[model samples]
Target: MDARRQGIVEVAARLLRERGAAAVTIRAVAQEAGMQAPTIYRFFEDKDALLDAVAEHVFATYVAGKAQSAGDLDPVADLRAGWHTHVGFGLANGALFALLSDPARTRPSPAAEAGAAVLRARVHRVAAAGRLRVPEALAVELIRAAGTGVVLTLLDTPPEDRDPALAEEMLEAVLRTILHDAAPVPRDDATALAVAFRAVVPTLPTLTPGERSLLTEWLSR
Candidate 1:
């Protein structure tokens, strides 16, 4: 990224933290960055673009910290750690979190995709260990949805009225729904087969490249 563009994003992110999304005007960011409003246009198409860039910058930084903190412990424990980190981040950075969670965004930003990829890898580990009771994709979706929902709910509540255990309860509920008891017993279910196939899809040489791609897509569903 260009220095000027990065500078603008940094200023915009700070503004977002200081004031809410409604205050992140292009003119305000440009003024904070010691540049003209028109200069901001050279780097960003519009205020929405600029806000998206700010969201990307902030989220990427948070996810980087999350990656650094993650360790190769038990896969399930690692996933729990990820869940805690995600909720904590959302609570601390409410504006950036809300921007990333906006339903109107439609297409996800690169940072959002990177975060999802991290979760997918963690879920895949659970599946590979034969501990996932649900399809890997489904488990990822459930966890993502639950975590986001919990954060949003907490953000909406008065701090004093918030349930301290809400986040943990939601996480444990999802875990019970998606994880197996004991060591993964041999299961012949379709979901299990799909998850196991997805784990090794990259190494399947029996199928042609196009076939493998198609199969992988199908299994992901």
Candidate 2:
């Protein structure tokens, strides 16, 4: 957690992302951190240990940064704010994103559980508030899976080619899939949007860094 240790982890992640994990040796990480290889060995036992640390550091940084921008509104807004951060962070840090997403890395880390807890709480709150009609646990799973699908689809396209129209197309597809019923139910506090947004936001991750930025901007405004 010290500056030098943190720096080493970050430099290692950059290397792991730029090169593959195999390419990130102690010597390489130390070189990037401008420290001697022995210094790294003091903090990390071996390549595997360092790799684990790097993975943890990346997820922690991401989650911490995201928690900052999440405004303390209702559960629906909280869910949307978090999704936007997740998608944006994933897009901008795709290499780190892919690495952390590997099941091997996640199995040993608490990061995944932390995210799950946040999702569970969000879903539970929305359901309790009557903003979401689905069961809390089921809602969390459904929203997470749906959101992952949306993000993966958007990320499959090149970022440079991602325009607003393309984004709108994706959003519309997502809306249709989740909000399949047309009949009106009693609206929630934020009007129809409270219902619509809650139904949609938790099911998707932030698809791009731009979307994440938009959420932060919205929070600020």
Error of model 2, residue 55, in angstroms? 3.7
Predictions in order: lDDT: 0.86, 0.63
The residue-by-residue lDDT of candidate 2 on 109-133, one tens digit each, is: 4665666677776655564455554
User: For residues 1-221, what per-residue lDDT tens digits would candidate 1 score against the true structure?
Assistant: 99999999999999999898988998898889998899999999988888889888888877787666555778888899999989999999998889889998856777888899888888887887777877877899999999999999999998999999999999999999988764563566667667766777888778899999999899878
How many collisions between residues are there in candidate 1?
0
Off by over 4 Å in 2: 20-22, 34-39, 68-71, 104-108, 163-221
Clashing pairs in 2: 87-206, 147-203, 147-204
- The lDDT, on a scale of 0 to 1, for candidate 2 is 0.63
